[model samples]
Target: MPVGLRDRIAAELTAVIHGGDLKLERYAGPPGDPGLFGIAPGDPVWRVHGQATGMLTGGFAALMLQSLHPLAMAGVDDHSDFRADPVGRLNGTVRFITTTTFGSSAAAREVIDLVRLIHTRVHGTTPDGRPYRADDPDLLTWVHTAEVRSFLAGHQSYAPRALRLTPAECDAYYRQVAPVAEALGAREVPRSSREVERYLARMRPGLRVTPAASDALLFLRRFGRTRQERLVVRPLMNASVGLLPDWARAELGIHRPAAVRSCWDLPVATAVGRTLEWGLGPSRIQAAARGRLAGARQG
Candidate 1:
């Protein structure tokens, strides 16, 4: 296939995934500028995070898992219009990740500052009347870990061979992304897969399925801004459910046993994820990172 055709197809699919407002031509950052973490093109995080499959599936799984935390959910519930404007939230998230991962340091810091400012005002009570704040260091840690964990898992499960990270690379990815989590006020953030696992285990007791959490999952499962998007939700939701930890699966009432996972869930998730990755072609931010990398090597 022609590169133009492939890129066009990928961009269209990406727009649907991100709510149709994403235009690759508008994705901007200075060429040759390393972002806040100074992650290079060869970094494990660059390989893992650049995969569309892992990002979408992992992000979907993380949202479901994170909602189990009542305090975290409360902040989202009170402040976000996810129900009314799902794409806006998704676009914001995409911008944050892309900027941090591949934009200039100034761009990354700008997003971080914006998010921190937003966090200051995102405080509320859960339905059971417990207080919650987005910027609480502990809450920030949970959210950050969940996102990174899910992204890694999604990459492991969904990315094509060229994009997949080795075990060492995976750990490196965890380490690379940790600084941003800390900058976001996440304390004692996990920097490896094992540490992330241990943190989740320790956090289990505090996690529970509330009406708020359940409703959020349902909304996500059914989320789509367009007829085209609605068509793609089922397989993606299936993939998201499959990526979740067992504890999360139980909490969300998504039961796919080992046999089912191996036989059905994994394959479907892999296929859907890869399809998106292929359809979306190369991300503009990642292309910029590659350009920077090439220039540095030549210099």
Candidate 2:
């Protein structure tokens, strides 16, 4: 395809993945101060978290995993307008991730504080008469771990060759996200891939399907800003479902046939992933991140 067409396609893909939540304004102009995290442009995370494909697939998987937690699901179902305003919820999520990842220290802290306050207000009872609070440190840790793990897994599986991560790099990524997890009040967040796996394994006994989990899957597949978006994201969603842990896939009732898993999973994920990379080559967000890395190097 021509450059212009490719860019247009990439832009559309970006919009769909982000649910039109990407705000380039924050990243415009010459690179400013390093974000709160001070992540180097060359850091593996910059590549891992920077890829739109990984973020989308991993984010979807995280939500699926998170829904397994009854308390967490209760907090969301009771307090969130996710079903009523899916795009708005997505926008807020994207804003938080981008701000914390690329925003200056002050900006990042501001977003973190705001999120903490929101968490404080989100407390309720599960249908079974169990109390839940979003700010509970344990819950926070589950949410944080699930999200970061999904992001890393997606990147490992789908990121372009230039951005692929080694095992060391993956461990480095876990380290990279540790600060944000801590800032969010998540305790004992895993800092290595092995630790992450162990953490998930330990948590498995507590995970099971709930109505909210079922609803979450349906919501993700059916809601989008546009018909085209809903249609386009289906394959990515399928790929995401395949990426989930076997238990998670079974819980969601989205388990793929063994034939499909062996024959089609990797190729489909690769095609969608590479197309995303080609289309989303570089953008203002990355440029801003590069600028921060440069500034950090100078200082």
Candidate 3:
């Protein structure tokens, strides 16, 4: 069977994370001196790794929604601006994923889920050698919460709309979400509105991240925007014959004459005609033929 989109994305992301391209040595300024102040200077490899991880994770979260709730996918896609801002997009996506499907526990449990998976892959052992459970402090829950909260606080300053609810309303929302949290074996769901605020506050201090990591994250924020633009343009150019749509093309003003020539001159019609002659279904065969033709030309 063909690989599902989620698995393919997960595999690619895992490879990127483990590729060793993102690692950076801690800079030593002078003997016993603190390194570069404010923003730590970062290596290009770190930047590339951070950017790739952000893109993959952001795309993965969006795809997860697409898998779980088709209607939510449209909401997510329509909010492309939110998606373009990596921090905002990620927080928004996580909130939507949890709240829509799981409610209040959504935020807490999803954080644990992502963290546990990442840790298990990276460390090669869970607490019991049976895979990390959601409650494990070092391996499972807290680490995930710290990472998610760090990402959110680092990138976003705006409060979620969910916070706009009145105390009573918020309490009701929490109550509604409590069952999901309970099912996940959360030690304690924030019982009241005040407890929720306090829970977040307590988690806040632990979310402090190193300057080098922050710089790495900032690089990812910028890289995601650039990739989004590239994705939009590549498809448009592939489908059309004439001048490309402005939205679909880069603004760098560097023209790729070779690519333009290849795209226009390629025997797309001949390839399609041959595939149709093979008695295969038109749509499926055309797609397969196009892929093969593209591969052959590249080879």
Candidate 4:
């Protein structure tokens, strides 16, 4: 039986987003698997990661923010072929995050270990002549903090009210997701909203946009397979920029006016969010994980 037009359209989008690796079946049973952190519909991680509009924009925002750290950017610029293979790079990241979030425990651990092993070989020196390694605890912490902070910001700013996290839930999301970073060998990870802010402030003196990062940002901003896709992505990119802290935005050279943000970016973000919901119809990945957990409970 056909799944219907909406589902087929969604499948295509998922294929694009996951880069043709929609292992939806992997999110299914064998029961008793909660992946890394157990999936509850109302859980902070689930709520934040479930919203497509938020995740997409958040990801772009995070890359922009992450690139500010010279050492972190150094490892990425030297080792990643993101220049020639941006989609491949994106697919790898999506695989790790979605799998760890929704795949079975064994699957999640497997991906985590693979990433750790890959990190072992990723080392280089920044332009300023400081040696950097992907596995460095401090670098890992910076990457993780910047990413989740942007994610939370995106969810708060763009997701529908029903999907948005409360202030308390936002705090919970950070605390809950911190362990994932720690498992990747990050130490002293921030586990609360305030902790993350303080951590970012403490790290500010070392952050800046290098030339390589500038090039990368330009590439991300302009990426899309078709004219239609580019049109859709443009507002989301601007909305992502809108979510950045004033200081971070100033550093990144983003200065969208408040009036434009309210009149244009936010409205477009909302429309896109609804369009995504119409197409994707709640997350199939989250549904599969829920089914997997329900089976365990039934058993």
Candidate 5:
């Protein structure tokens, strides 16, 4: 069966969250102490980095399936923007926090809830002490759209699947996802077949860069190259990482120290260095991606 709009959007958003400009900001910071690799104490940057890493791993698919809690928190209210653009809003909140914190579905959900809570605390009250509905559609739509587009732009190079849909198919799928889109308040979900094809064509290159692969690239960029100029090179590295077989993880020391050094130059050159020395794990790619995207928007 042909990939539907939801699937394509999911894939594209995944790519953006991984290797896009958002990833660059979170992982492109200056290298930290090598000795602290795995054993390093928690730092704001590291926490965010870890979260980005998790997103690229298995958690991304789970998030897409709506099996994640943050999505559920948005509820199914049509009047709420969260319903229209659950993915987008979720992505925005995720992008703002530390990626390392999102190693599991539970962790990711906690971070997301926290973000919403914080935002509400900051902006959802009037001077008269009346609490505005935290579930406003306009706010939700803006937040989700910004985050989603940022993720897509960041991972533009990794998109692989073409948005090739027959006019009929495009119309049908659009209708399916339309409720969600409407809740998100997106202008429209590609009304015509021509528009659908064009959107798909634009998004194809990014689909190839899976979330996990994008996280790997960010990992390499942070620990390996260390040069600002090489930041743009991570998407390519991510593409390669996505293609690696699961069997290669052990042999390649994907979770080990020596791999870090071989992959990139930094204070810590080994996976052991990152884990034992700094307490950083290869998980949390997704959170980190979200953080980076949020940071970019802020910057």
Candidate 6:
């Protein structure tokens, strides 16, 4: 693509990802602010989240996985703005993740505290008379597990060879990322690869294919602000679908052939990821945080 078009695409994507929630300046001029993780050069969270394609794909898969739990889906179905303003909801989610991941220590905690506050109001009874609360420790753990696991899968599959994490790094990511969920009052949040797998397996019996889940999936497949943006989102969703576990695919009625998923979906998503990486270059927010850390070290 030409430089102008590339820049335009980059701008649009940046707007979509940032949602006007994080200012470029928040990351700058903060000497010695190591942010929440105090991540190093090769921190697993930084590397995994740096891949926009993987994050987008994994995020959608997380939604799908979360929708499997009727209680979780019920909370979103009743209280969330997903149907009326899907993009806006997406923008908010992007804001929270980016802020918590790349913002300064104060900024990161601010978003987390805001989310915890919001969760206090997100309580209701499900259609089947079951009660659900966003702050419920078990529910929080389920959401956290589904989300980060999906993200790791996306990065492991789509990120460049040099950036793709090894098994050890994958384990490291799980161990390191549990604190955010813990802070939100999640109990027994999984902290390793084996633990996560076992947790998901243990929770499978409680999952279902409710009408709300189906509607949510349909809306996700079709959501975008414009025709152009929608076009770009299609392959990303396909790649996300490809990332789902076999039982999840069956539950969601996803019928794509395995070979097509491996051959077509992965390649298309990889190409899109490369385009994003080239267009976006380094994430501005992360750069600012890194500068702050370097400034601290130098000081």
- Which candidate should be chosen as best, given TM-score against the real structure? 6
Give per-residue CA lDDT, model 5, range 1-299, as digits (tens): 23364455344444433332244333322233111112122322232123332223212222222211122223322123433443455455455433322222333344445655644433333333434444455445333432232222212212222422334543443343333334333454554435544653553332233333333333444432235323433433333333233333332334534455335422221221222212222334533434433443466
C-alpha lDDT of all candidate models, in order: 0.80, 0.79, 0.31, 0.84, 0.34, 0.85
Pairs of colliding residues, candidate 6: none
Model 1 TM-score, 2 decimals: 0.90
The true-versus-predicted C-alpha distance at residue 17 of model 5, in Å, is 11
lDDT of 6 by residue, 232-281 (tens): 78889999998788988898889999999999999998888788778887
Worst 10 residues of 6 by lDDT: 20-29
Please give the range of 10 consecutive residues that has the lowest summed lDDT in model 4.
1-10
Clashes of 6: 0
lDDT of 3 at 37: 15
Q: Pick out the ten consecutive residues of candidate 2 with the lowest summed lDDT.
A: 23-32
The TM-score ranking, best first, is 6, 4, 1, 2, 3, 5
lDDT, candidate 4, equals: 0.84
lDDT at position 258, candidate 1: 82
Q: Which stretches of candidate 2 lie over 4 Å from their true place?
A: 2-4, 10-32, 296-299
Model 6's alpha-carbon lDDT is 0.85
Scanning candidate 1 in windows of ten residues, the lowest lDDT window is 22-31
Report each candidate's C-alpha RMSD, comma-separated, in the order given: 2.5, 2.4, 22.7, 2.2, 20.7, 1.3
Q: For model 2, how does the per-residue alpha-carbon lDDT over 14-118 read when each residue is reduced to its tens digit?
A: 564465546554543234576677665678777777877788888888888888888898899899998888767877888788877776677678889999999
TM-score of 4: 0.94
Report the candidate with higher TM-score, 1 versus 6: 6
Q: Would you list the rank order by lDDT, best first?
A: 6, 4, 1, 2, 5, 3
